[model samples]
Target: MFTLIYITASSVDESASIGRKLVEERLAACVNIIPSIRSIYHWEGSMEEDEESALIVKTSHELTPQIIKRVRELHSYDNPCIISIPITGGSRDYLEWLDDEVKRP
Candidate 1:
């Protein structure tokens, strides 16, 4: 029941802070932070574009809810982007390592 959680933050520092909290709290096995990314979307009936940071979190499916909740608490956006994707396939060893790193719910 592995999963990858994708989250967008206003800046690298914010993303890093959230990532660090997740890892420290044992809610995530690993987190990859993309320092800079351009995002274009509609907000409040207007097209908006901005530079943001992306965070990829690796952990168990059971932890997704808590991860989402935690991210919301730390996020700045009124509606932060936090989505989870199931890990249907991957290297067995790495997956096992992921399981080992994150606490089982």
Candidate 2:
């Protein structure tokens, strides 16, 4: 099983740091950083808006909890967005590559 974990951070540097850590620790196969994302939501009983960076993480389903834990530990936001959607399908070669990259010992 595989999953695509999506997390939004406050800055590009933070996002990159998270990505780097995940890859370095062998928790994720790959991470794509999308910067300058505009987010609008209700906060503190008021409508608020801000800019953020999105990290798209590719890894095994079993690793999602560890990934989320690490993200929470490193994140700046009190409530960071850490969502995982199961990968229903993908290219066989790419998926194989992903599997190889994130294999746990």
Candidate 3:
């Protein structure tokens, strides 16, 4: 099964950096980074709002744990948002490519 991992980073540079690391390590097949996003959510004891970058990462379901671990290690935020959702369906060729991209040697 495939998975789509959603992560929010403090900046575009940070998001791209994490994406590159994940791809380079074969933990993720692809990562689409959204440069500008306005995020509003509760944190600690108050509501918080900030401009952030969002990353949509693609990988196999089996690699979820590793991806999360790596994201945390590279992420600047003390508690970053890293959520994964199952990819139930997609184009065959694209899915195959995604599989190959993250395949372990």
Q: Can you tell me which runs of candidate 2 are displaced by over 4 Å?
A: none
Query: Residue 47 of candidate 3: its Cα lDDT?
Result: 100
TM-score attained by model 3 = 0.95
How many clashes show up per model?
0, 0, 0
lDDT of 3 by residue, 1-105 (tens): 999999999999999999999999999999999999999998888999999999999999999989888899999988899999999998999999999999663
Per-model RMSD to reference: 0.7, 1.1, 1.2
lDDT of 1 by residue, 1-105 (tens): 899999999999999999999999999999999999999999889999999999999999999999989899988987899999999999999999999999878
Q: How do all models score by TM-score?
A: 0.97, 0.95, 0.95
Ranking by lDDT: 1, 3, 2
Off by over 4 Å in 1: none
User: Lowest-lDDT window of 10 residues in candidate 3?
Assistant: 96-105
- The segments of candidate 3 whose C-alpha lies over 4 angstroms from its true place after superposition are none
Cα lDDT listed for each candidate: 0.95, 0.93, 0.94
Q: Pick the candidate with the highest lDDT.
A: 1
Q: Residue by residue across 1-105, what tens digits does model 2's lDDT show?
A: 899999999999999999999999999999999987999999989999999999999999999889989899989987799999999998999999999998573
